[model samples]
Target chain A: MSPVLRAFLIISALLLLAPLLFPSVYYYRIGVLVLINTLSVTGMVVLLGYVGLVSLGHAGFFAIGAYATAVLPAYGIPPILTILVGAIGAALVAAFIGKPILRLKGHYLAIATLGFGMLVWMVLSKEAWLTGGPDGMVVESIDVKAPFELLGIKIKTAIAWYWICAVAVVIGIVLATNLANSPAGRAMRAVHESDVAAASLGIDVARTKLTAFIISAVYASVAGSLLALFNRYVTPDTADFLHSIEIMTMTVLGGASSVYGALIGALILTSLPQMLTVFAEYENMMFGAIMILTMVLMRQGLAPAIAQLFSRGRK
Target chain B: MSEFVQFCFSGLTVGAIYASVALGFTLIYNASGVINFSQGEFVVIGGMTTAVLIASGVPIWLAAPIAIIAAVIAGMTLYKLAIEPARGAPLVTLIIITIGASIFLRGLMQTVFDKQIHRYEGFSGEQSIAIFGAALLPQSIWILGGSLVVFVLLVWFLSRTKAGNAIRATSSDILAAKLAGINTNSTMMLAFALSAATGALAGVLATPVTFTSYDAGVLMALKGFAAMMLGGVGSPAGALIGGILIGLIEAFTAGYISSDYKDAAAFLVIFLVLFFMPGGLFGMVRVERV
Candidate 1:
């Protein structure tokens, strides 16, 4: 079997079997969050890792997906269709802004994306009429268990959401892996190394980057949609600057260049807060320390650093 | 007309603060191409320290200088502990490191001080000075005057002093500066310290008008960054111009347009300006060698 297929099967098996070790519904909820974050971070791997473009505003897309699900349903749109609508909306927004902002390099690009993210946040928070202001709004939950019930399996809501998110994550990983191995993916990597060189080599550098941006935006949108559906609530906080940073941190912390690294990053960040509830006030401090230490000690991130260690041991 | 004057006063007051913050960014960026995201935290530290000290019965004059000293220490500590250790890392890594430092400092502040919003009495009393039908607060004058004094001092330091010349030399070319026997590392540390001091001074002056809290740094950092970008990165004059422009624009927007969208105006202006002039108003157009 191909490496992609093998990796998929392994991940699928783990997702299926991991639930057996879950102690309660709370763990399942956290599992769902991890998978959602993993899905989003996979997109980060493609954009930041593959194309070497950083976006400090992807939470804007996430918020779009979430708000679409929350508000569109009230307008008689089907809940499931909102996900598709949200993805399309996010894609269009990314494309529209990406053209002008992508021309900026480095700090400029970071700030431009940040500006866009803040604009989205402002609109969501200030337009209380549409988004229910900062208080947020309730999301109409989708019946994920309906099909399973038809099959005579009565799974709990959390378990059903967990399975659904796991399936989404698997699909997301497969697609990302496929992209990573494709000709276009090669172009992205080439751009990541040197956009000038890529351009000289006849690659449409701008087009390639926009493609990555759009794809990543779609992934974030879908992940946001899933989170909204699972939680049955949506807030403007979903698209805040801190949320964007959290997602970026997860992507970089786990090793932005690898899918498995994305998974590791999502798992650790998602669960660390829960474990640190005992020292609640110290949580941010610990997080900041971890980020600094990680970058200073292992700039390649945890996964690549660990991989190197193991390979060196073998040598 | 009076309303306009009032807006202008408020605009200039806030603009002075933003200018100080932007100057901090310019200093560090020039010395070491790292955009210090924790610049606003220096402001917070300055203000918070002053508030805490004053509350503990320290005189205002004593509290203010102590706060500035604390911020300078924090700045040097950040460079030595976080930034220096990550030397030669990628730009993205440096950015994250600074952001991490900001978060760490914010957490430290939250732990060390209470989360309540705090501010000391303005250097002058709370009386409003009436000018052309507008009520101008005495604190605004202090903020404006204080910022000007800091700016003058900074310019004199950069242009007239030996250490300032060393910083300029390092900024122009690190290798060349080192070849000429300048300590680039120490210059960088000095840049960080000066940047922190500028930000802290702004905080000390403006806290009386805007108030201060642990979370206030985030918005200040964002606005300061916007000002830096607006004026053009790495240019002190640009930072000053951009910050004043941003403050004026925000004040006018709040006065005429929806107050809720006042913050949005700065970003919208940035978008428009970047599209037309990527180099900013005073920034030199960059030419890539490659």
Candidate 2:
């Protein structure tokens, strides 16, 4: 099977199997979070992993998704439709803002995105009339629990959300995997390696980057929407610069270039705090230390390196 | 007019802090092209350590230098352990590493010193002085004085000292500087140490006003970065000047516009500057080399 097909199969297998092996339903709920983060970071892989662009502020997209759902209920849109609106809003804003800013590379791009993220954060925190302000806003829960009840087996809200998130993750992975294999992905690689070479190949370097950014924004938005619905609440932290950096960290720590890398990265990061709760207060320290070490030791990220080690062992 | 004077003092005080932080950022960027995002952590570490020490019965004067010394060590450790190993990695990797280092430092500090807001008595007492009809805290004067002293000392060292010339040479062209028998690695260590010390000094001075916490590093880093960019990358003078400009803008925006939008003004200025003048205010745009 092709890499894309292989990736899809692998994702499906894990999503379907993880629920069965869970010690309790809480693991699945946490797994749902990992899956959601996996979707977000996979989106970032298109920008940071493939194109070699670094955005310090993708939480803007996340917040947009969150707020779209939060704000749209007054308009009487169902929770389901609100997600689509959020994704589209994120994409449009990304494309519009990205058109001007994407031309700059390195630190300049990073700062621009940082500003954009901060701008969104400041707005969300200050605009009490619209956002419910810094107090945080609640969303109308997506009513997906009805389906499990009809099947005559009651599933925990976490489990149902986990399945929903898992499906979303699979779709995001499939889309990103296909994009990475297409000519466009090649063009992105070309740009990433050398913009001059990419331009020489008749690729619109600017446009390619903008496209990646928009798509990545969509992924983040969807993840944000899912997170808001999952928790039934949203805060400006959803789009804070630090949160943006954390997402990018997930993308890099998991292996920026691989779809499965995103999954592994998300899973490790999401589960790390819970696992390392023995030193609960020091969890962030551990998270930070692991991130730095990962960059220093395994630039390819944890998943790919482990895979490499195992594959070598098999050989 | 009184409001303007007060704003200027406030601007100058905050600007001095920004300048110090920005200068620290410039030093690391000058040594190794990586803009260590953890530069702000140096400030946090300094302020937090000082707070801890003072609370533990150390004099504010002694605790301040000790905090700075600790920051220096943290900077060198970050370089030797995390940064040097990742030399020649893509800029993105470098960025992530620094960011990770910063996050790690923040986490470590929180563990070491619990997450609590900290404040200390100002160096020159809590009295406000009348300057041009505006009542200003004496700490503001110390902030202004400290900033000037640091910048002047830095200039003198760079222009008049052998080590300073070695640093300048290395920054202008690393390979040529190496060919000239300069130990670039030691210079890098020196750069990190110096920047960390400056950051610590700023933290020591400003903690009275701003308070200190592990999370404070994020905004401090962003403001310092905006200052650095405004002053042009790799220029200490630019960092200082850019920092003051940013502070003044913040003060003015808070005075005239929504106080909540003060952060927004600094970012907006940075965006506009980078968009229009990529070389920054003092940085020369290098002819593109493909």
Candidate 3:
């Protein structure tokens, strides 16, 4: 009945029908990746789009999640429980550092996050004893097919992961939408408009920013844990600087403002590389060019730009 | 004590090179508000171009100038094509643009020069001289002297020359500079060229000691940025002082602690400094009026 509910239904239907249309395990895997990326970018919506804060270090949280699942299983923790724990770990880390880091504005914040991401990458690569030392370690496989078997429906592992990711995304959207409508979300938007102004209105600017940062970090961690479960392997590359940039690019490219925009950004960026295999070596160049052109052409990004075009067309 | 002196000497050598790059960063940041993340790429281009040219039978003397010229052209082109077009964009957008430009330059270099590390012979022979019971390479002296010369020259230019004054004016206030009939656009272009030349020279000087690669630019940029932040963002003297301190810290860290964590020292120092003194050592404190 409501637009939010209607949008959720449409997205769920699309996710459900995608497997039927593609009917390939490979496509399902890519879809799962898109879903995972979409989950993370949705977090970016709160941080970058809502609060107007940028973090170049989210891959650090993503790494923490993946590594927790990879390493915690050895410590006898169940894989499923580890995912939640990983998210919690990421949230704690974010909250701990967010106070000092959030104090920095603009490029200073960017560089600080850059330093954090690089530190994570270095630790993941250098601490070979724990993290398998750059070569990475295998993750314990998750059992998502148990529910499907209980329902008497036969689904391949890839398709099962795809469905799980889809359900997760739907839940993520509902949460994001709910948050967008809440007082905290309004405070976040107000912070985006002007932190000083928000402060003037009696909002605790520091707490609001930290809240956005921690939420976004938790989202990234969860998405990362899901990715580890889906692939059954985790590498240090999962938390590299470029991957951090890629996440940011997707957020900005898709329009950072809304949930749907996060999904679109993830889908396009995930699919574009596969489609443009010939330009594989020039990937960095393309990324750089896209970021520059996007900012110069339309700062609000693709989804918002397209929405404006449609509105203009109606006029 | 000898070991400590040795570490200090090594620190000063690397510090000098970092100072050169930081100076370039300060120049561009002062003239234009943009922190050109691609500054290190100019260094790589200079080193790689010189290496490839020498390998291709060009005399070393001729190759060096040619390499610098090439980087200058690249710098100017980056300004005109990428930065100039996106004037008045938000700080985040500008940061992304510069980062993108850095990525693009690295990719282009990888394609053109392959992924191999490169270095030419130092200006002098590969002889080590003893100073206070410490061994010093001639290349180290060159790197230190070269950076010092550049610093002195920059100070002179900024204080004495009309073009330098124009750049300073533009940096202080673009509108006021324009009203005073100074060409702000040309000043920006000059800033790009001068910074690029300085970066390229640092690369040329340090390559014999540190080596150069397509991917090295990112780390160098990060280190230079850290150095710049340590001294103060836009102050030339601050850049030199900060770079030396970082280099000394790195050398001491490597000497005393695990060399494996030596690189981490820079980031740790950055965090500590930013936490305690956000404006850096020599940076002016600005009061925000809202």
Q: What overall lDDT goes with each candidate model?
A: 0.88, 0.87, 0.87
Q: Could you give candidate 3's per-residue lDDT for residues B167-286 as a string of tens digits?
A: 899988899999999989989999999999999989888888889998888778877888999998888999998988989999999899978777777788788877899889999755
Worst 10 residues of 1 chain A by lDDT: A278-287
**Winner of 1 and 3 under TM-score:** 1
lDDT of 2 by residue, B172-283 (tens): 8899999999998888889889989999999999999779998889788889989988888877789889999999999889988889998888788777776788778888
CAPRI tier for the interface of model 1: medium
Each prediction's RMSD to truth? 1.7, 1.8, 1.8
Fnat, 2 decimals, each candidate: 0.58, 0.71, 0.59
- TM-score of each prediction: 0.97, 0.96, 0.96
How accurately is candidate 1 docked according to DockQ? 0.63
Error of 3 at B229 (Å): 1.1
lDDT of 2 by residue, A206-291 (tens): 99999999999999999999899898999999988768877877888889888888998888878877777754557567667777
i-RMS for every candidate (Å) is 1.8, 1.6, 1.3
- The residue-by-residue lDDT of candidate 1 on B106-201, one tens digit each, is 888988997899998888889899999999989999888887887788888889999999998987878899999999899999999999999999
Residue A25's lDDT within candidate 2 is: 82
List candidate 2 stretches off by more than 4 Å.
A147-154
